[model samples]
Target: MSAATSRPRLVVGITGASGAIYGVRLLDRARALGVETHLVVTSAGVLNVHHEMGLGRAELEARADHHHSPGEVGACIASGSFSTEAMVIAPCSMKTLAAVAHGFGDNLLSRAADVTLKERRRLVLMVRETPFNLAHLRNMVAATEMGAIVFPPLPAFYHRPQSIDELVDETVERVLQISGIGQASPKAWAGL
Candidate 1:
């Protein structure tokens, strides 16, 4: 597709995970790259954004090209026909992970992810939990088996990040790279 016609669209889902900043950063990056974004946030995600980033729902929704209600299962993104480059759940909660792993489409976020998987489009889950139990491990495995890329926002010290924002940016950069929408980054490793 030509540049004018091929604006890549990405579906971003934010859940109740601790690192709501990841989702925020992803939106900023996608916007900078001229990518269209469809965003969905769980109710718990709204609470976490307030608790963690002090951002209100309107502020968060304002960052995206379109925002879908969590309960809006009939939304355009819920269908496989919606042409998107990929779907990513930054700070993917264990609850969201379990729902997606089991094909649970209770909400628009999960339904969009399910549609992405079935349509063979890229689906990346930035699972934001630690101290994984057996169930979490199994859920990750199951999601991977179903063609989801389970990414944890593990800190990388090799770049010697000076601040938390740098770390978050680097992780977001990597996430975009995995989705084939990466931007040039100074932090990218040059290899030893």
Candidate 2:
């Protein structure tokens, strides 16, 4: 089915950052919401996912409607003509952020992100790094200036989340909402 007729398409990129669960949960949640997903995982991303979640590449790729190799620079997503609502790099590594910040389309993931930005589509970078150094902060600023939302998956205590799943789900829900594909019942912060 065509994306417009059936479901909105979202490009998901998973980098080598520590929080692999964010990317995985994003795929699952987007599917539940009937959104078509195009996944691209870097090699380091695959390794980290396996190390963190014990999920192999095939297992992880199975969560999405379509998956692309990082080296597939000629993939449909690499072009601006490809219609996609938005692209989110969940757990975006510092290296990936630098590439996107500098307009370096070294691979499919960064290339797709560049396309997303040039097309004026939403490109959310869920950067996962602690102890932000100068370069990391600068790259984030550069990406933000270029219309990429640099989102860090920090837990919110306002929701009083009881479990890790709840925390992750809440964060993913926020991301979906930000990407303009929000769920029917999104959790809102009712001021205390």
Best by lDDT: 2
Name model 1 segments beyond 4 Å from true. 1-5, 182-186
**Residue range with the least summed lDDT across 10 consecutive positions in model 1:** 1-10
TM-score, per-candidate, Cα-based = 0.95, 0.96
Clashes of each: 0, 0
List, residue by residue over 76-125, the lDDT tens digit for candidate 1: 89987778888999889999999999999988999999999999888999
| Model 2: colliding residue pairs | none
Question: Per-model C-alpha lDDT, please?
Answer: 0.91, 0.93
| Tens-digit lDDT string for candidate 2 (101-146) | 9999989999999999999999999999989999999999999999
The per-residue C-alpha lDDT of model 2 at residue 78 equals: 100
